[model samples]
Target: MTPASTDAKAIWRAFERTARADPGATALSTPGASVTREELATLASKIASAMRGAGVREHSVVTLMLPNSVEFVAAFLAVTQLPALAALVSTRYKASELRSIWAGIRPDAILVPPQHAAGVARLLDIERQHDMVVPGTDQVLRLLCVRSSGPASVLDVRERFGLRDPGSFPALFKFSSGATGTPKAVLWTAANVGAAAANVVETMGLDASDVVLAPVPLSHSYGFDLGILPLVFAGASLVIRDGFRPKTILTDLVDERISVFLGVPVMYRVLNRTRLDQVPDLSSVRYHVCSTAPLSVAQIEAFRRRFNAPIFQHYGSSETGGICLHVPSEIALRPGSVGRAMKNVGVSVVGTNGGALPAGCRGEVVISGEATAAGYVQGETVHDRNGFQDGFQDGCYRTGDVGFLDADGFLYLDGSRAGVVNVGGWKVSLAEVARVLESHPCVVESAVTAQTNPRRKQRVIAAVTLHDPAEEAELIAFCQARLADYKVPRRVHVLEQLPRAASGRVVLSADDLPS
Candidate 1:
């Protein structure tokens, strides 16, 4: 499809077209419930009607915090069908973390599980609330509308947040895992969302016959862009699992005849270690796509030996939907590379001068394509270095990833420009972890770094000089309270003094840190 064709397709409308074509086909399934294309569409329509009655309109922002269930899917579709932006928040986030993110997006409404309604109401100063039963499940969702001083208007919200007016209102809103201090809120226009889904369909060869099993959270960009979007654009079947259980996932792989599996490196690592009664034939599986973190050659080999399916590593960001994916046919030739750019996407390595570097020279990875987001939103300014150079339609995103393109155009990542460590699939900022540790009264200063373990991939390690005596577990527990579990250091070392250079900057390395 050309840019013009994709530009005309809205994400929700694309799903509607697919649903109309195959109304009886299974659109989504969970262990407890299932929904056909027609049923899911009708559910979304009903929810949209209810939202409209509650004063939701075009340009309104609705935050969704739910687990990976059919209700989450319907809520997302319902919001976008109204042409309102849907902001996805992880269900695992604590109230403190939620407040930090809400300060930027300032959602007009929030949809959460009934158990979380009281917490959300307290945070948003909700003026009205209602209990709504999810169509196909026993679950109940609490829809709360924030208190308003005057008439409901998107203009007031936009001005308050300092968001620019794109030609079209954005269809999706997401927050990055904080490259530095605070998480950055990003907005993607409907065209951008559609283009991303189209690119995945074209590149991954997805269709109505394929059944995908997604254990990852659909709220994440990895799952939303690849899992949900593909189901809508290609009319494929989706099997959702709330959490990962190796034995249960193994059984579902064969029971469901899943054709595609969306996962991360940590999942593959666990699966490799899981003992199966008997290895079942998984020939029905066409693609086992891994993203959110890098995969080691050993892990890839182990998976291929066990399942006879090669693991394809996908590389992208929340800002850019799907950049590079290791295609099945090219897996052997480009073993370590994240493969070439996805269809309709461009990837280049450029030096500081902004000129394209030679194939063998390492430089900043730049992306320009239909899948790139318009720009950062909420409190982030588009003029920053991370923002698009021109605009989403004709501009490029300077990805902070440091890598070089091979002579054959394959991309290999060396590292990121920022101080980030990948814990499982979640990106944890080293500076942020250090700050959390320093906040503890027992610590005078702290340094955090990433250490690679053969069994666990990458884990966060911290060293601290303490004014008061404290055990490593105590420090870790403190971090667990203040930060996300992934950001919490796996191990904490009590140090008398950290190695410093003449400039007084802590010079700490994983190798030099005490075990």
Candidate 2:
């Protein structure tokens, strides 16, 4: 399709048309089974029918707390088929976390996996006494349980909320991690999801023949946009994995003939340790994309050498979707760069004074484009009078990421905005230091955060998980060889495992770490 013909609205309309035209084509696959387009459409239709039957209406928030599987896909699409909004909650969340999220979102209904049905029921019962039905009646908060083998029982509920206009359907409700503060929900319209899918498909050069293996969960933005939606929109085959297992992924690559592999940095690191000889032929894979967090140059090179495929770096967030993607040419030129801004997207590095910085100057990275969110749900607006600013510009989301662009427009990430260690007058990016430390052969993973130091206002501290425990002095010497004197970690803490989010992002909150 031509560029103009491949816009978001157009692609989504195409998806609908294709579904009607060829319902029998394989659309999705798991480890042991697959779902054809016809089956997907039928299941989604049935679920939507159930929602309509349950009194769901336009703009109603429907919470989805299920694992990464066919049921999750059906539930998401089913919710979208109605005018009600869909909120994706991680299954990894504990009951306490779910209670907090429920209070915040005040969703009309929650679709829970059978495993968590009893806990969800108890939580809803507690909310019932408080009379906190923000969007609808108490009956609206019904649970749609999935049987192990038979059809889902929520068909009647969906039918009660059948939408007259699919265009008005609210796509998703994404919640930010409450680590920084109270968690906030981001509302995404069907139009927004369609646009994001189109951008990703075009940016990645995906086609019908491509088989995508998504290791990330559908609840996360990276997996939803970069993994699920793109393949569905392009009529490409989707191979869904419940979790990230290097051996399992390697097997899928060979068994499914997966052309596209999308994962986080940690996933790639795990895959690097896999015994390639034990897996089936993986030579069919084409592009392997990594996102969510920065991938080190060493890790990128190692992955490339092992897989013989280009490892592309992508940068974006939940609020903005995918704003930047590195193409093959750009990847070759700037090995660790997050490439230039995506097509139809504008990116800039702004200083503290709010002015754009020249190339090679470190500053806050900001982005503006069609794919950016309209606003946050019940929170601050994403854009301001200056065009785009919230975190960065008036309308532009302050990425909270610290980076600079080269003359060629490639972006180099230093660290996250919250990760900088302010030492007296200097700013040290933890990611930069951690990368250097992790390059050591014995180091498996590492995180750098600001630690209290009476001698100085704050000092850089490193928390490392090693394949084989190494002495602090050895680690310090390793960092000294690669990092600057001031940037080298002043204190080192060894841990067996690093705290991680469901999205696979390394959690580095100082309060969560052992003192």
Candidate 3:
């Protein structure tokens, strides 16, 4: 596909082209059934017709609550046919979270599996609702359909979906993981959607023959860009599943002849620790991609030694599409580098003065590319008061990430700027402290934070989940040896697991830390 054809309309067009080329080819492979490209496209059109009947216009928002399945893909594609915004609500979220997001979005219609109909209505306090089932696929998907209540719009067209010029027509509405703070509603324009899909397909060298096994939620950016968008751009096959299951995933890798694996750090950590009686041959798997969170060197090494495949680290944000991916050839040499800027994407590290920092200097990571989103859903953009800045031809997004790029343009991340804590007068890096703690043989994962003492002083603290027996004092001592005394954790808490969001990102508040 050429740059000229990469537009929001290209997403649906590309899928249609692939279906026309080979309709019988399997596009989505689920545990229940396999959906051909033609079948899926037809399903999308059927759902689009239903949505149109429900007063879904060009700028309407259609919320999706289904899990990762053929139903979700078809519903999302259906939204694109109408050229409306698909506000993806993950089924993995709790009922309260669902209600909150639904209330904020106030979508014209929502699509869900049959079982959640009553619960969704009750939670969202909907007095009247109409449900229609789209038959096909299988028993589960046969009952999957859209529920339209014809809700009144709360916000105007521009404020609701962030629709502006023709190039900035909203396509997707997703919430950030809120790892650093409260989750914000993000809007991706049609151009952003087309460019995101194209960038990943081109950068990763994905093709129609590649079968991607994705256990991540399609509602999130990481899964959508790497899993579903590739299928739209390159005609690749998608093996979608709801949650992570290491053993079952291993079985599918061989049975399904998987080519690409998409996952987060937590899933990789569990898979690294999973004991297998006999390791299945994964020769068919070409790429093992990890995103959402950074992978420690220990994790990268462990997975490499166990599977003989290097874990390719993917770095990006919801506001910005794919910023960088690990260069396969340099993965071994630069163990922690997140690769140079992605194809057609420009990455720069800027200092506090907002000037681009020299190579090898750590600063805030700013991404400028065709794939970058317009801004948040409330009509913010690169030139607005938001973190985004306007300069590059396509505009730039301030990623709020702290990292440095080497002379060769390879990017290495330390952590987020918000991850820094002030203890006494010295500023301490929580990620550096956590890194030292996680490096200990017994620690599997760790989270570092700070708390204010009675004297109004910030106290650095840490928490760790260990694979073997270990004490808080030992972990604290371990960090003390590596980090400066001021940066060393004043206390360490031991836990079986840390609280994480649906995206597998460690979301910790000061209250979440043990006193």
lDDT of each: 0.77, 0.68, 0.75
Ordered from best to worst lDDT, the candidate numbers read: 1, 3, 2
Candidate 3 — which pairs collide?
none
- Is candidate 2 or 3 superior in TM-score? 3
Candidate 3's C-alpha runs over 4 A off are: 2-10, 94-104, 114-127, 137-166, 281-283, 379-394
Residue-by-residue lDDT tens digits, candidate 2, 1-515: 32133212333344566577677888888876688877876776666677666555544667888778777776676765664567888877666767666665566777765556667777664222111111211222235422112112233222223312233223566766623533456655455566677778777788777888987888888888777776557778788888877777777777777888887877777676655665344446777878877888888887777776668889877777888888786676689898878766678999998799999999988877656664454422222213443452344677777899999898988876787767767878788888888888777788888777567577788888876669999999888888777888887788888876655567676666666
Per-model tally of clashing residue pairs: 0, 34, 0
Global fold similarity of model 2 (TM-score): 0.84
- The candidate maximizing TM-score is 3
Per lDDT, the best of the predicted structures is 1
Ranking by TM-score: 3, 2, 1
Question: Which of the two, 2 or 3, has more lDDT?
Answer: 3
Local distance difference test, candidate 2: 0.68
In candidate 3, where is summed lDDT lowest over 10 consecutive residues?
Answer: 378-387
The true-versus-predicted C-alpha distance at residue 108 of model 3, in Å, is 1.7
TM per candidate:
0.79, 0.84, 0.89
335-375 in candidate 3: lDDT tens per residue?
78877788888899999988999988999888887777766
lDDT of 1 by residue, 3-43 (tens): 23322226678788889998999999998777999999999
Q: Residue 433, candidate 1: how far off, in angstroms?
A: 18
lDDT for model 3, please.
Answer: 0.75
For residue 5, model 2's alpha carbon misses the true position, in angstroms, by 15
